[model samples]
Target: MEEKMIVLVAFDGSKAANEALSLAVKHAEAFKGKVVLVRSLKGGADIDSEDIQTAEQDLAYAEQFCRERSVPFETHLLVRGCSPGEDIVRFAEECRADEIIMGVRRRSRVSKMVFGSNARHVILEAHCPVVTVK
Candidate 1:
């Protein structure tokens, strides 16, 4: 049996994240791979009710998006007191994903220094190759 390729997409409901999802679907279709959509619920706050509901809604949207494209996909919500970047990388590793797709925003150097960059962290820490869409 041939090993299947998995594409991991980090989604946060942003336009750039939508683009990343689209690109992941395209890759999945082209490579006959599966897509994994992940959303990180940052911080250790007892998994806020609103956040859980929002994640459910977002995952539903992601599922529909994959269904429309006829792509095989699964969704994961990470709320284990980890940063989004850490969650993304850890999920990718756990899934043995062949590639990771993420949305990146243009941040000024000062802002990046002050706030840190999740995309940057993922890019640096992920085991597989990362594709970033702005």
Candidate 2:
């Protein structure tokens, strides 16, 4: 049997992220594969109970969306002390992901430089194809 296509999606409880998830589902369905939703957080003092709770809620929302579509899915919350991009790339490498999907916002170069765009990092660093949703 052919190896199942693994579509890795970066989820962050945002509208753009939801759009990315929708695109991911379409890709997974086309390939007869599964969707892996990932959310990353810089742990320790960077995260709090409310943040964790919000993340879980986000994952749950995505899970329900996948289930309703009858799409095979799994979710991951990475609490590693790293940027979301790094966490996502590492997880993709570990899972042998076929593609990585993420949401991006329109921002000035200065804004990106100040905030450090995760989509930009993932696009540059991921071993597989990277898809961006705005």
Candidate 3:
């Protein structure tokens, strides 16, 4: 039998992220693969205890979503002092994921210039194929 493909999905509780998560779950069910939900905390932010608690809540939601769908899912919370995009790429590499599903925000040129796009960076840097949900 062929090796089941491993899929890594980045979930940030955004609408696009939720869509990507749904798509990843559907694809995993169809392909008989495993799904890894990765949530990364960016550096330099003074995160309070409440913030961590909120993150845990989000992770729980992701887990529940997978359980409801009966899809194999794992949750990974990465606390590296690095950009979220870079961390996601590294995690994908470490997991040997066949594909990555992430969300992309529609941004104007001015916004893109002022705030760099994480989705863009991930698309450029990731070794595995990326599916971005807008």
Clash count per candidate: 0, 0, 0
> Candidates ranked by TM-score, best first?
2, 1, 3
RMSD of 2: 0.9
**Which stretch of 10 consecutive residues in model 1 shows the poorest summed lDDT?**
42-51
| Candidate that would win on lDDT | 2
Worst lDDT window (10 residues) for model 2? 42-51
lDDT of 2 by residue, 17-112 (tens): 999999999999999999999999989775798989999999999999999999999999999899888999999999999999989889999998
Q: Please give, for residues 83-125, the per-residue lDDT of candidate 3 as tens digits.
A: 8889999999999999999988898999999988889889999
Off by over 4 Å in 3: none
Instruction: Give the candidate order by descending lDDT.
Output: 2, 1, 3
How good is model 2 by TM-score? 0.96
TM-score of each: 0.95, 0.96, 0.93
Q: What global local distance difference test value does model 3 have?
A: 0.89
Select the stronger candidate by TM-score from 1 and 3: 1
Q: Kindly list the per-residue Cα lDDT of model 1 for residues 1-134, writing each as its tens digit.
A: 98778999999888899999999999999999999999998857466799888887888899899999899999988887888999899989998999999999897999999999999999999999999998
- lDDT at position 46, candidate 3: 81
For each candidate in turn, give its C-alpha RMSD to the true structure in angstroms.
Answer: 1.1, 0.9, 1.5
